[model samples]
Target: MPRMLDVSNDVRAEIGDEEADRLLAGDNAPGAYDCTSCRTPGNTEQELTSTVLFVGQETAVLAFAHATCVPSQVVPVSEDQLRGAVRSITGEDTAPSYAPPVPAAAHAAAPHFPAPAAPPAYPAPAPSPASPATASHTSAPSSHAPVPQQAVLGVTSGVVLVGREACPALVVEPTAPIVRPGSPGHGDEFLQLLSEQGFAPVVDLSRPPAPNPGWSVLLAMGRLHAVLMPAPGGGRPVAWWQAHSPMPLSEGWRGAVGRTRKVLIYAAAAGTIGTQPREDQLRAALDRAAARGALVGASMPLAGT
Candidate 1:
């Protein structure tokens, strides 16, 4: 029987046409699956299903979601989490059991993070809240500009999975309530303002945010500087949020930017997402914000000094 599977080009490219065909043919696809995005039961034979592949450092797990909920794509995650997800979906533990150690000769052929004699390039591991980060003064390019009460903007750096890559992301939040430029009372309208500027609500994190042209996150000397958007009148780009003092990027984040050369920017109203000490925590907060419609995001090309 044929399944209503939607294997996107990105997923097809990674899993190869042969494997994708097998899935489409129902040889490997599950008849009923718990949609990874919405966590609801779905039948591939009845409705369109998306094949979401979670690729970790070592293991890869294939999961299914509603195509209406999220498009088929690959998401990069830690090996442990990947195994846990596999267990949840398959109802069988995926943890590695005891096995005989491989011979040293074979170990030499093993593939790992760094190649032979390669430098250790890791980032997003050193969770630091006392680092040389910055607080910035940014602007909002909205016809409905908000009046910042404590308008001081906070920028947090982290890496998020978009498709098959670990891409750099910035979370921007204000310190206090932001209202209309001449509002009489305290009310948060940050998300509304950003919507007018092209940011989209994040219904699912598995898919990348919508592209936001004429806006970008700038880094100078591998340091986060500001988020620039098209000027209101038209001369040079202006800051939506400009770091008063640029913050240094981690080796991992800088390397990711070097490879992808793009950044995903997410914003929430004041107090929606606080300063999280770790990336995982930050991701969790973003998830909560997204669930409640407090999150807005845009994928912008990288900009510089």
Candidate 2:
């Protein structure tokens, strides 16, 4: 059967003008599909769309996007990154990559940041009755100290249902399991760290915490770059977590952030959540966090690229 598609000059150059013409005439293009970049409904038969190519080491996938979301250009990404994007779109567990690697310099030049200065010190440990006079100096919590090595937060986006209503959600997973800064081989205390900073534990998604201003999600070049948190010592924003390769967020997500001026951010201390999960799995995680009162909800303004 003929396919309906909009072939950009760049794509045409790769696929050929004859094929491009055929696609325009619904001869070589696929019918309607989700825009790879924006995750919105797009049709080659109705509006101009870009044919995006994803190339990996041994596999490739052809994806579609709105011309506005991504101009006619080739995007070279890692195989894992490409798979993540596909999982977000298809609501599936696995996807193969197609775009070839871009210049090494392009990937290497992406911004990098050291972890924020140790959060305000944790409360001092309880004083020992036997050492009442030395308590002030001796009772300070050993856990308040900073870790020798820094950790990174890996941010992924997905949808969570609240009573059958799908809500745009951002999941934060730390590169290393988060434990108290000075507590090696200890239990994860990541959620506790956040709670100390005023991210009220989420007891229910239906009832989110009041909006907290000054925090925002930063996007650059129409991709997920970082989640900004208020500076430790009171200055400009600091990246709580950043991506080595910017991840593309769906258009619906962008719109949701703009319209709601809020986002549901959930964090797990020991492990991370996949972009794609069975509905039951998602709900189970939600129930677990709600049970522990560890989920965090905040109002984050949208900052676009």
Candidate 3:
């Protein structure tokens, strides 16, 4: 519809050049529709979008999504699934791999956190007119661990200075080697795993890391809650790393998050960074890790205020 949309070659081939051209001309497209991936409303006129065609044994349904969430493509569905999708009130399908555009509860004043299942929303705490705060948090209350192996993940919250800017940051390290699941080898795959999930090697502290789409940090009640990752098969997001109990954030760090609405998370293998009690010390450790290509990071958008 003369809207900014991406119709992949595969999708075009399946939908046919004539029908695809009709969609491109806006005759077969809607001005606004709910995103098939994140279930949020997107207007083709306002933002870049993708046209997803869901085909089944004997029928097909077209879906829309923000381009940032997923690229235009054809998703195969079962006949019963396609029929159920047509009967569904939302006209949405469940299996497309996608990232969210913006979380539904993203506008809360302070923070928003989601559980592994259904997450409850929380109101932001009252803001105090105090100076920006900084703190390093390691130990906390618990219910979950980062992995199923014998390892302790230490998460520290601190500020990383890039030139004159005090950027909010989180440091993750394990107390033991992290072995890959189902692998017989004992070699650590910590960075390898994170890299596979979209974290890139941090080359320079002077520049902020690129934002990793479909990945974000969840904070609630003014505290660190969990790091949310895309769902395994792509529906609601799930926690990639969660605190047993939410970790505390200082006024400064919290303020920094609220101001920028993004968190810079840096990770390294165990012993590469430990007992970084001060912000300066933490920054130094990060620099050292980056020097050796041991650091991986992403500037993730906050799911809440």
TM-score of each: 0.52, 0.49, 0.54
- Each prediction's RMSD over C-alphas, in Å, is 17.0, 13.4, 13.1
After superposition, which runs of candidate 3 have C-alpha atoms over 4 Å from their true positions? 1-149
Instruction: For residues 103-195, write the lDDT of model 2, one tens digit per residue.
Output: 222222212233553332212222112211110111121233454334444454655666555556676655444665556555567777777
- Which clashing pairs does model 1 show? 138-241, 139-240
> What would the per-residue lDDT of candidate 3 be over residues 1-305, giving only the tens digit for each residue?
38777889867776678877877787767787766544457888889988766555555667677777666866543344344445432324332322212111112121122323211111112221221233433322123323345565667788788767888898877767665655677777878878888889997898888788888786533456567777656764556665544355776786576556688989898789877656887898899999999999998985521
- Residue 291 CA displacement from its true place in model 3, Å: 0.8
lDDT of 1 by residue, 164-260 (tens): 7788788877666666455676767667767877899996777879888888665432345456676655644555654434355666666566667
RMSD of 1: 17.0
Q: For model 2, which pairs clash?
A: 3-29, 38-251, 54-98, 54-99, 55-98, 55-99, 60-98
- Each model's backbone clash number: 2, 7, 5
lDDT of 3: 0.62
